[model samples]
Target: MNTSKSAGEIRLIRLDRIEVLNPRERGSRVFEEIVRNIKTIGLKKPISVTPRIDASGAEKYLLICGEGRLKAYQALGEEEIPALVVDVPDEDAFIMSLAENIARRQHHPLELLSGIRQLLDRGYTIRSIAEKTGLNHCYVQQICNLLRMGEERLLIAVESGGIPINVAVTIAGAGDDDKAVQAALQEAYESGALRGRQLTLARRVIDKRQRLGRAAGRTSTTKHSHISTTTVIRTYQDEVKRQTALVRKAEFSQQKLLLVVGALRQLLCDENFVNLLRAEALTTMPKYLAERVWPNGSHA
Candidate 1:
């Protein structure tokens, strides 16, 4: 594999002739956001492509990256789009796509795992993947090890920070043997791979999985669910309503507290109450609560 960078040509290419090598599922909100920004400011950067010649000697291009931008242009019915045509091979193009995907902070763990698996399938060593993707070698190995163990749930737990990456790797490769998993967990604790809440979460995951008759090898047909634009908007609206209600409740409580404190301060000024307090030697007043009732140092 060529590790050198290619300085490709920048030209306008017909959208119909470019094929998407790896298509990713983008939420409608993301697509719309891209479209809105592009419409207002035009495209900020050109999409990347690699030139290819078909069997019939016709020239076409493979899309290396920028699926969202390309799709936005297509939605606008643009026939030709500007692209940077590179002279790299198909393998490097795929790597570039994978690197871009992994670089995104919003990318799902499953999507990242898929990209890593594709690279591995293409005979790229784990070390090479680490170097190409700029991921830590240990992290790359951990993900590959988890995939090999078929530990989907554990992988999700790891991604969610429920457990340490190394601990997940250890338990994943322990097969379905409970004793082996426990032993591995103990080893992780001893080696500082598991500590604090991470150790607790790891034990809980093991117990929950075992109780549900689940293991790393369990074949779950469930795929990652993508929320639509409508769902996202609805969720945001619901959250706003909930927060508004909480704010209103807090304001009401504050008003009630002020009323109660004000009444108490008035009662404190009464001769009988003042005499009782003087007799009991409680005249100092609870400094904290008194300050709230008399913020300006005027009791009444």
Candidate 2:
């Protein structure tokens, strides 16, 4: 646990002699960056190591952390770099590796959740896992909720920050019945039809229904009943009409704003240059002229 820097002489050792604790768990980007940096400026930071005693009382050194840095050094063809040798227990080695990897590059929430779940499945309690991973218990619980979601797309949304963890946890708790609700929320989000507070509100509504279902010991059903082909066609027609009305309203508003801007511009021009007949409205022209001529005139 001691992190105090101690200067030691650089010694050349066979690269294969060092034992890497968690080689597979190392972040790829971090490893790549370390390689690049070592290729450019050499290994700036020496790796931390610990000495192990063999059966014959022979002492050997093992890398406690810095697998990425070690790989980068090896890639760069460096024979020796200063290392900090410390005595640490074997049980803490994997935890240290996990923390180092996480610190180097943040894992996606879902990825982190998966790692936590793996540890849990291996018989580690939430508290023990949290202590080992240096994550909060609440965070561990939130990640466990991913199992409840049962939908890969929904889990991705949560990991990408498109959905809040609490909202995701609610959706996960919905069991099988919430599939339609989750789908609806996903469609609204991807289609840009729902956003900001409205998206959150929709998630809350779905979550509330899910909670109710759990309490009742019954799965919640989609409110939208299956429609016959004729009914589907009729519904499509009704939606088309609604959308057409909306588009017209938007177009009208845009036209009005454009007209107002044009009027404002015409009024700002020299009075002699303005064509009264060509203007949209004589009333607007006079109002513009009055505003220009009388500085104190009430625009109201």
Candidate 3:
């Protein structure tokens, strides 16, 4: 958002009058982080707004950017916020807003796609989008195709960094040919285009997309229940509990193994016990237990 070394004119603006140019659903992690950061350290950057004269000639600010920060301040119950007032045409303001939101930073792939579509609606070509946003032309085209096809799941995977951009492009070009898609992915993996854990994640994403045809629960038999923070938090808590129990059991098992090894070492060192073992025709201890009891190749 900081376009130059010199700062812009900062002023206190009424939060209620500023209109978000491109609004999105709230409660995402970015929104939560913005709220948390404002509460923790105050707003780090002033929002950008353009001054507009309404029908009544009253000064109203059209929010060119900073929807997240604005929403966070509203959530904090603040009536006014610090903002940078910029004098620009509405169209240019929108372009700047789009640049800051989608192109400047790493964003959710879906958001980037939507923003690109918005830019296209605003009459910007692919080359213009690339020049303004600093994205490659091919990447913009691929995103446009994905958006047009409504490939939400693939877009999600791309956004999450589970698959590479090149792989996604290849898959998008593969159309409905599952075999060609698989071949392309395999070639990418074999050629070292994808490596290590990325291949595993890419496979999972492709399989899940091919099988479910969308994100989980989208194609369910029953009616789609609304997704909310509470349900997600509850599921996370359950998983945490399960993992905690498993960890505790593992620790207990480790402790028991140590105790048994200590006891066995003591018994192996006792001459009477060795004699009793000899008399019982149990001279040779099990290889596993013997290795632990006499780790240094001792008499036992």
Candidate 4:
């Protein structure tokens, strides 16, 4: 981004004269808070804009950043607000705006990646975007290629933070090469980014894309989140834990049953106790007990 020749000088501009080049959708709660903050403390940093002359020879200011502050001023019934004027081309101005928006706060991984995709869709070169956004040139290239290939499974994994960007890149770079995919999974597993279940997930996703093609893969992949690469591994881990607990409980019950049956069989084998029970008129046994103790149907 080019530094302003104005050198921090703030100029007051009318609200009507400023036009936002790209209007972003902000939640009402956030917008209201912006309005409240400006009302209470006033504008801390001046909004940035560029002077543009329309084809009709009318001049208007193209807003490069600070739409929130601009809108807050309007809601506050203010006619003019301070702005920092910049002289740059439209694309540079837009990139500058995007950089500021991204740098303002931590963004959700999906939102940040989608924003980069939006810039790519706008025909900006990967190197230019990397330079402007302070991202690794290679990383930006990989992201552009992955998004271009419509590899939503890998992207969703990255977006969900289940897998890191580098891991996703590794998987996407494989692209129909089974050996490469296996190598990528091995790398992820060794690096601790992927566990056994996650490795399984990565393989399934790659296999689907390879078998059904990207269109079908994306369709089936999204309809059910249980199969999604992001949540599937965790879900499988939870299920494994539950199954192990059930098996342990079953084994415990089996042991207790064996102990009870052993004690009963031993007591029944004693002639003195058997004769005593008979004398007490207790010859009949429950059918289930008889079936277990004497398998030949001999109750006494």
Candidate 5:
């Protein structure tokens, strides 16, 4: 996070003056627990606040995080609370708040990734995103890479804990190369990271990518627009059967053509056959077969 524009100072601010720009709904039970904690142990962290001028040209503070704590303070009838004041844009403040929510594990896995993606979109450095989200730098970077390539399937798998991020990255980098993807999955399987149903899931995901593409459809996800296992299996089987039939037909045609070529080549070696063909004006053979029977276009 660009420190020059963030984490300015900690100061007391009126609770009524702070506007929760991106407030999340906390369960009643959770809210009560937070109130109890603050009452018993006092607030451990201060709320994050950024100043913005309203249409009336009056300065007001926007709450970036610490909603629970701020609420706890209000419940305790406290008029003012300590807030970490920062000077940043509304968008940056919102992203910071989202990162803080993710840090607390208050968001879905996809939401977490989306928040990281938003930060990356804002041109936040990987280290900066890691700092804001309280995530590992490598993890943030991996998420950025996955989002950049639009590896929606692998991203879903990663979020669902179906595969490792490294494995997903490997498979994604493999692109349309099935062999490379298979190799990457095989390595994951060998490492004991991917097994059993997850192994099957990995295969299916790769199969989906092969048949369709890496991107998930507009509204597709595991819960919605989900492709069934039987569907994927049937599709694979049908493709294999079609390909096998084509190869078999090609082989049969090649055998018949070779037999004809062999007989014609033998006839071309006979003086009578050559003379008879020359006399009948049906002497011209295809250049390919002629070259095959008579080396360097030489006549018998």
Candidate 6:
């Protein structure tokens, strides 16, 4: 440990006392690169630390941040490295860890997602995580999406930045049906398909397959032979005529109903015309004539 006093205002401590916060389960190539840099250039920047008081009233320095750099220094077997000690609460320790990682630019996308998942598992909400880490809510939400992907090969690609974040998000929202998701992913990989296109194709294929399966199942239970060509043609022609008649009848009925409705609306709007019709019916009009003129019980 090499400690140099600068301005005598800040006390620098050794790296041995600093602990890692929210350690990642997966190994990071980025961390290896940082270790290489440290081996070549030495410890250029000091990591941040905070004091944590124990139940016995003894204060110990806990690493509030800079986990990657600390790991690098430890791997290099350095006896000590520079650190800054401050007072911080344990509840805020994870936030400091995230900040330090972000500042050092050592955490990869997957590692960052893993850390976010850790914080969430520890009961941190997305809003609180964003506030504490100084990140936007959307960014935190995106990381949370990656966590939702869980332990899948697609998630691995997402973490490695091989897959776009949006693509990963779409895949994550596919839910826990592994076979369907895997099939979609396979198609995507084989065809170099976009995520949206992949999802659309998958849905279409599934729907088509389901329809075919239902048709097949229905046919399998019934004993039916192929009809003769003449019979088929006759059946088709009959169906066409039937459909045509139905359509024409529907059109005619619609027009008739609309005309009747319009005429009734006009009669209601014209008080004079309605009163005149009513008077005519009440006078010496035949019962049949009156019924014909006002079929709906209206005066006109």
**Clash counts for the predictions, in order:** 0, 0, 0, 0, 0, 0
> Given candidate 6, what's the lDDT at residue 120?
89
lDDT tens digits by residue: candidate 6, 109-177: 555655676778888899988877677788678767656544233444545545645555655565455
Cα lDDT of model 4 by residue, 24-83, tens digit: 777788999999999999999899998777777766788988999999999999999999
**Candidate number with greatest TM-score:** 3
Overall lDDT per candidate, in order of appearance? 0.81, 0.60, 0.77, 0.77, 0.81, 0.60
lDDT of 3 by residue, 66-107 (tens): 888999999999999999988888888888888877864656
TM-score of 1: 0.62
CA lDDT of 292 in candidate 6? 49
**RMSD score of candidate 5 (Å):** 21.9
Q: List the RMSD of every prediction in angstroms.
A: 10.1, 11.8, 9.7, 11.1, 21.9, 21.9
Model 1: pairs clashing at backbone N, Cα or C within 3 Å:
none
At residue 50, give the lDDT of candidate 3.
85
User: What order do candidates take by lDDT, descending?
Assistant: 5, 1, 3, 4, 2, 6
Candidate 4 lDDT (Cα, 0 to 1):
0.77
Clashing pairs in 4: none
| Best-fitting candidate, scored by lDDT | 5
Task: Give the residue spans of candidate 6 off by over 4 A.
Answer: 1-9, 24-42, 55-58, 71-78, 102-106, 134-136, 145-152, 176-300
Off by over 4 Å in 2: 1-13, 25-32, 53-62, 108-111, 147-156, 178-180, 183-300
lDDT of 2 at 131: 76
Worst 10 residues of 5 by lDDT: 219-228
Residue-by-residue lDDT tens digits, candidate 1, 89-169: 788888898888877778876678778888888898999999988889989898888877667678877867788787787
Clashing pairs in 3: none
Residue 211 shift from truth in candidate 1, angstroms: 6.7
lDDT of 5 by residue, 80-108 (tens): 99888999877888887887877875555
Using TM-score as the yardstick, the better of models 1 and 4 is 1
